[model samples]
Target: MNQNGSEQKHYIDQYLREDRMPHIWCPGCGLGSILHCFLSSLIKSGIDMDKVVVVSGIGCTGRAAGYVKLDSFHTTHGRAIPFATGLKIANPELQVVVFSGDGDLIAIGGNHLIHAARRNIDMTVICVNNFNYGMTGGQLGPTTPLGARTQTSPIGNYERPFSLPYLAAASGAVYVARWTSMHVRRLEQTITEALLKRGFRFIEVIAPCPTTYGRRNRQPTGLDQMRYYRENSIIRHGADPKDVDIDLNGKIIVGKFIDIERPTYSDLLDEVMQRAFGTELPKDDTSKEEATVVGSAPK
Candidate 1:
C-alpha cells in the first residue's frame, strides 16, 4: 500500500514471511542459498513481481513457492510442468517459472520433463539437484551418482544417474546450464538467460543437502561441501557434456553447457492458427439458371 493508490514495491523482504523466517530446512542445507540466489536473480532481472508466477512440486526445494510472495501454485509431486503449462497457455504474457527437486523432475515426472523440452514450451525450469531425495530421508534419485550411499542404498548405489543438463539439451531445451551453489554469479546469469529465453530453458543447480547426503557421504558441513565444489568443479563456457562426469570420490564438472535459439511452442501454435485461417475459400460464381441447365437442380 502506498499514498498514490498503488501497491508499493519493496524489495524481496516484502515478499518473504518473517514468521517463516527460521525455515524448516536442516542446518547447512543448500536450498536456502539457492533460494537466495534465485530471488537475487529475479530482483536483478527487474521483472514486475506481479507478473511473475512461481510454480513448484512437492519436495524440499519445492518450498520455494511458499517463501516467494509472487503468485505461486503448489502442485502435486512431480507435476509442476503440466500445471505451469496451463498457466502459461492461459496467460501468455505472464512469466512462468517451475522450481523442482531432482527427484521430482527426473524420477517421477521424467516423461513430462522430456516432452516439455521437446515441445519447446515457454517456461523456466530450475531443478535443484542435491544428488539424493533429501525430503524423503535420503533415498537414491535419478541424479545421484553411481556408487553413492543413500538411506535406501547403504551398500552404495549401483545404477547410473541421469546427466540432467545433457538430458535437457538432448531433449530440445533451448537453454541448458549446470551450476553448483558455489557459482552464485554464474548461476544468476544463467537463470536470467533462461527467464528471458522464449523457449524451454532448463537450469540444474547442484545444491548440497548436508543433513542427509553430505553427512552420510563424509562431507559433514556446508563448508566441506563448498570446498568440494571449489576443488572439483570446472568453470568454463561451452564445456562438452560428454566430458563432464562425476566419478565416485572424484572430480565434478560444472559449467554452462548449452545455449541455442529455438521456436517455442507458442510461436509454433500461432503459426498453425494463422495458416489455418489466413486463406479464403474458393467462391462459387455460377448463377442458379446455369446450375439448373447443368442438371444440378435445386432441391
Candidate 2:
C-alpha cells in the first residue's frame, strides 16, 4: 500500500535489481525507456510485486524478467505464453505478464499468440518490437519494415512486417495499445490500464535497437533513433485499424488502438466445469467397465 489513500504509488527503486546497476543494453537502446515505463506503471498501479508474475522469452527485451525483482520466469524462446497460460490456470490469483521481442512473440510463437488472444486469457503481453532481432545480431524480424538494412538484408528487406497492434485487436485482444519509448508517460499510463483490464491485453512498444539494427541501418545512436520517432511518428488515439499502415520511409502511428470487454478464458472455463462436472468430479468413481478385445473373451 502507499502512503496516500490511493492504491497506486510506490518508489521505483523498490522494484529494481540494484546489483545489476548497469544494464547490458546499448547506449541508444530504447529498452531502458521501456523498462522505465513498465516500472512506473507497476508502481502507479499499486499492484503487489509478489502477486505479479513476469514471464519472458529469449532476447534483449526478454532479459527484463531477470532485472525486475518479482516472481519472474525466464522461459525458452516463443514459449512464454504457454508457460504463462499454465501459470494463470493453476493460480488465477497471480497477475500474469509477458515481455518479449517481435521475433520472439510473432515469428516463433505466432500460433500460440493467436490462440491465447482468441481464448481471451486474463493476462497482459508487452511486446517490445525493435524491428529486427537485436540479441543474435541484426536480422530481419516479422515486424521489421521493408527496405530496412540488416545484417542478413545488406541490400534491403523486401518482406513486409506484421502489424502487431492491428493483428492483436483483430485477434480479440480486449485491450490493445501501441507506443514508442519517446512517450514514456503515456506508455506507462497505457500499461497501467492494460494491467487493470480483465481479458487478454497487448501493448506493443516500438522501441529502437541502436546497437545492432541502428548501426547496420546507419542510425548509429540512441538519439538518432529518438529523433526518428519524433519526426516520423504521429500521435492519434483510437485510430481505425484499417487506416493504420507503416511504409519504409513514412510516419509511424502510435496510440491506443482498441479496448473491448468479453468473457475471459478463466470465466468460461469455470462455466464449462460447472456444466460438465456438476460442481466437482466424484473421487474413485470409475465404475464403468473397460472395452474387451474383439476376438478374445473378457476374463
Candidate 3:
C-alpha cells in the first residue's frame, strides 16, 4: 500500500518477505542484485513455491534465506550444504537451493561442498564469490585472488584462489556455470535451468563487495565492479571448466561449462534399498510399525 491509500505491488514482492523490507546489504554491494536475480529466476522457473526451500550459511549472502518468502534455514557458518543435504534426504520432493558466499561455502565448508557434489546430491548451490569474507570485516578468504588486498593482506595476498567452476566440475557437479551480477538476464536464465535439473548443480556468481573488497581493489563502488565485468567478461559456452580461472583484472570466462547427466544420491539410495529389500522404502512411512527395518541381506 502506498501513502495515498492506494494499492501498490512489485513483481518481486511475492517472492520476498515484505516484513523484512530494506535489506542490510551496503550501498554499492552486489548482494542485492544477486538476490534479485535469484528471486526472478524462481519466478521464471514456474515451480511450486511450497516445494522450494532456501538454505544459507553465515555470511553477508546468507541473509538471503531470511529475506526470501519460501521455507528457509540460516544454518551455522559453513554448514549450509550438510543441512540442506539432510533436508533433501528427509523429503525428496523438496527443491533445496543453497545461497551462500564463497568464504562460507569454500573456506570453512569446503570439504562438505566437494563431498556433496561427489555424492551427486539433488540440490542447487548458488555461490556468491565476493573475493573476500565480506561479512567479517573483509578478511582473506579461500577465493580471494592472488595479489588482491584485503584486511588480512594489506600489502597483497600471496595465496592462489580456487577456480570455483573448475572445482565444482571436478568434484562431479552435473551442472556448472559462472556469471557475474552484471549478467542479470543470463544469470536468471541459468538459475531457472539449474532449478529444474536433478543432480548437484553449482553456479558461481562474481559479485561486488564494495564496502570491503572493492574499497581495497580500486573498484570502490559496485558500479565500478559492474563496469569491470562488462569490459572484461567473455562468454564462451561449452568451454572447459579448467580453463576458466579468474585473476585480478584479467579476462573472466563466463558461461555454462558442464551440463551432464549423473545418478543422484537419492537415485542410488533407492537402487540399494530395492536390491536389499526387493522393494523401495516408502517415502512417507512416519509410523514406527509401518517403517521397514533392515535385518540381514536376503541370501
Candidate 4:
C-alpha cells in the first residue's frame, strides 16, 4: 500500500495472465527474474502492447509465452523462430519476439536462428541460457559449458559450446547483447533498446537452473549462482564476440557487443517488388516515400 493506505496492484499484474499464475519454474531458477525484466522492459519501451506478439518453443523458458497476457504462440520444439517469421511477414505491423531456452533455440532451432539473422528479419529474440536442458532433466545442451557435468555428461562435457553473440553477429544480426539474470536493471534496459531497434536483435540471458543444473554443477541454489555472476561478471561493451567464451566457474564478459544497420527483409522485398512491377505496396506514414521506377520487368 502507498502512504495513503489504499489498495494497490503491481504494474506487472496488468501484463500477466493471472489465470496461469504460480509459474512452473523451479525454486532458485532464473526464469522468474528474466521474465520480470522482460515485462518491465516492455513497459519502458513505450511500445503499443496490443501490437506485440510473443512466440516460444518447447523448454522451461518456453513457458514464458503461455504466462504473458499478450498475443502469444507456444510453438513446437525449435520452431518458434519460423512461426515468428511467418507472423512478421503476414502482418508487418506486429512486433514479434521469440522467447525460449538455449536447448530449444540453439539446438533444435539452430538452423532457423542463423537463417533468420542472415535474412535480417525484423524481430527480437530473448534466449535464456541456463547452460543445460532444464526442462529435460538437466541434460547436456548446445550451450552447456565444456566440462560441465549434467545428466548426459556424468563425467564432463567434452564438446565446446557456441559463443552466441559471435554466432548472431556472423549470421547478420543488427544488434546483439548479453546479460545475466543477476543484472536485472541492465538486462531490462538492453531489452528495451532491442525492442526499439529494427532487424534481427538477439539478447542472451545467463540464468541459473538450481534445481537440475546447479545441484550437479556445484551451484546448489539460485542465490549461489547469482553470487557467482556478481563476482565474476565483467562488463566490456564493444568487445569482440569471438573473444567472449564462457567457461564453468570462470569470468563472464557481458555487454552490448554489436549494433549496426541494414535493410530489413521486408525492405528488400519491397525493393524487389518495385523493380518487378511499376507499382509498390503502401508503406507506413513514418516510412512513406515517393516511388520511383528506373526500370520494370514483366510481372
Candidate 5:
C-alpha cells in the first residue's frame, strides 16, 4: 500500500493505467507477473513508445490492452494477431505486440498464428499459457497436458498438448522461446529481445491459474506450481522444438528455440510495390525493407 514514496518513483507504473488498479485476476495467478515482466521489457526495449501497439484477444491476458497506458487494442477472440498484422502492414515502423492467453492464441487463434508466422509478420506474440481458460472457469484448452484433469475433462485429458515453441518455429517464427512466469527475470530478458527482433517472435509463458487448473490438478496454490517450474525446468537454449511438448508431470524445456532472419511480409510487399510502380515508396515504407524479414533474403 506504499504510494508516492521516493523509491516508488521508478515503480513500473509509467506504462500502466493507474485508474485501472485492482486488476481482476485471481489471487496467486501469474497474469500479474507476466504483465509486470512485459511492462518492464517495454521499458527496456528502447523502442519508441509512440510507435508501439499492444493488442490482445479475449481472455484473462487480453485485459492487458485495457490496463496498459499505450496504443492498445482489445480485439475479438483469437484475432489479436490479425489485427496487429493490419497495424504493422499499415505502419511498418510500429512495434506491434500480441499479448493474450494460450486458449485465445493457440486454440481459437491457431490459424492466424500459423499464417502470420508463415508470412513472417514483424510482431511479437506473448502467449500466457495457463493450460486452460482461466477467465470463464477452468475448461480444457489446446495446451492442457495429456491426462490432466479439467472442468471439461474431469477424469483426465486425452488430447495431446501442442508444443507452442515447436509450432512457432515450424510455422517460421524468427525467434521462439518459452518460460514459466516464475522465471520473471528471464522472461523479461526474452521479451526485450523479442521486441527488438524482426519477423514473427513467439514467447509462451507458462503461468499459474491457482483458482482453476491448480485446484483441480493438486497444486492448490500458485507457489506450488512455481516451485514445480523451478525444480523441473531445464534451460536448454536452441533445443529441438519438436521435442519440447509439455507432458503431465514431465520436465519442461525452456529457452530460445529458434532465431533466424528472413524477409518479412512488409519487406516482400514493399519490393513488389516498388517494382510494380517503378518508383520508391514513402520514406516510412522504405525503412521497412531493410528490417524485419522472415523469408529468403533478397539478392
Candidate 6:
C-alpha cells in the first residue's frame, strides 16, 4: 500500500474499488455519502469480503456495482434481483446484495422485487430513493410524491407514490428500515444491522439528487434537502409501516420498521428436497426431479 494519509484512507475498505475513484455522481448528490456508509457498515459487520456479491440494475444507483471491490454485477435494467437470486440459490454461502434505485427496483422490476421479498430470500437490498428518476432527467417515478412536478409530471403530479417501507414490510422482508442521507451514523448502523440479519433485508435511503430531483422539487441545493431531512425526520423505530407514506412536503417517518425471524426461501426448499430425496438435494443439479423420478435412481 502507498504511504497515504490516514484521513485519505477513510471509507477505502478492501471492499471498495479505489481505482474507480471520483465516481460519476453529481456535485452535492448523496450517492457518495451512501456508498461510504455502506462500506463502513460492511467493515463494522466484519464479514469476509471474498464472500460478498453486489448486484445492481441500470440507473444512477446501478453504477454502484461497478465501483464496489467485490463480486459485483451490472445486470440489465430491472433484473438485478433475479440475478442475485440465482447466485444465492446456487451457493447458499454467498452473501448477495441488490443495490439499485426506486425506478430500477420498484418500477419495471416491481414484480421481481415483491416476489423476491415474498419468498423470503436471504439478501440485503439497499434502495436509493431520490423521489424521481434522477438518472433519466428527473422523470416522474413510482415514488415521486403526489403534486410534485417532474419532467413527466410538469402539470403537478397527481399519482400517489409508493410507501416503500410499507411495501417492503407487506412483501415479507424480515428486516426493513428507512433513513435519509443526512442520518449518517444511524444509516450506517442500520446497514450493519441489516448485514448481520438473515432473510430479505431492505433499507430505503432517502437521498438528494440536487442536480435533478432536488433542483426540480424546490430543494435547489443539497444543503436545502438536508435541512428538510433534519427538520422532518422522525425516528420512530417501532412504527407501523402502513402509516409511513410520504406526502408533498410532509412529515418523513424514518426507522427500523420490521425485524422478525422466518424461514427463508432456501431453507424451505432444502426442507422439501430433504423430505423427497431422503437427503439434501445438491444445488448444482439442474434436473433435480428427473433423478428422483419413479424407477430412477437418485443422481
Best TM-score goes to which candidate?
3
lDDT of 4 by residue, 1-299 (tens): 43335566667878888767678898898999999999999988999999999999999999999999999999999999999999998689999999999999999999999999999999999999999998879999989899999999999999999999999999999999999999999999999999999999999999999988899999899999999999999999999999999998999999999999999999998787677754545454324333222223333
Q: Where does candidate 1 clash, by residue pair?
A: none
Candidate 3 per-residue C-alpha lDDT over 74-115 given as tens digits, one digit per residue, 9 for 90 to 100: 999999999999999978999999999999999999999999
- Give candidate 1 regions above 4 Å deviation: 1-11, 279-299
**Each candidate's lDDT (Cα)?**
0.83, 0.85, 0.92, 0.92, 0.91, 0.90
Q: Candidate 5 versus the native: TM-score?
A: 0.91
Between candidates 2 and 5, the TM-score winner: 5
Give candidate 6 misplaced runs (Cα > 4 Å).
1-13, 280-299
Which pairs of residues collide in model 4? none
lDDT of 1 by residue, 194-290 (tens): 7777889899998888888988898989789988988888776788776776666688777778888888888887677667755342112222345
TM-score, structure 2 vs. true? 0.88
Model 6 — TM-score against the truth?
0.91
Worst 10-residue lDDT window for candidate 6 reads 2-11
RMSD from true fold, candidate 1: 9.4
- The clash count for each model shown is 0, 1, 0, 0, 8, 0
lDDT of 5: 0.91
Candidate numbers, best lDDT first, in rank order: 4, 3, 5, 6, 2, 1
Give the better candidate number (1 or 2) by lDDT. 2
- Model 3 residue 140 lDDT score: 94
Per-residue error for 100 in candidate 6, Å, reads 0.6
> What TM-score would each prediction reach against the true structure?
0.88, 0.88, 0.93, 0.91, 0.91, 0.91
**Candidate 2, poorest ten consecutive residues by summed lDDT:** 283-292
Off by over 4 Å in 2: 1-11, 279-299
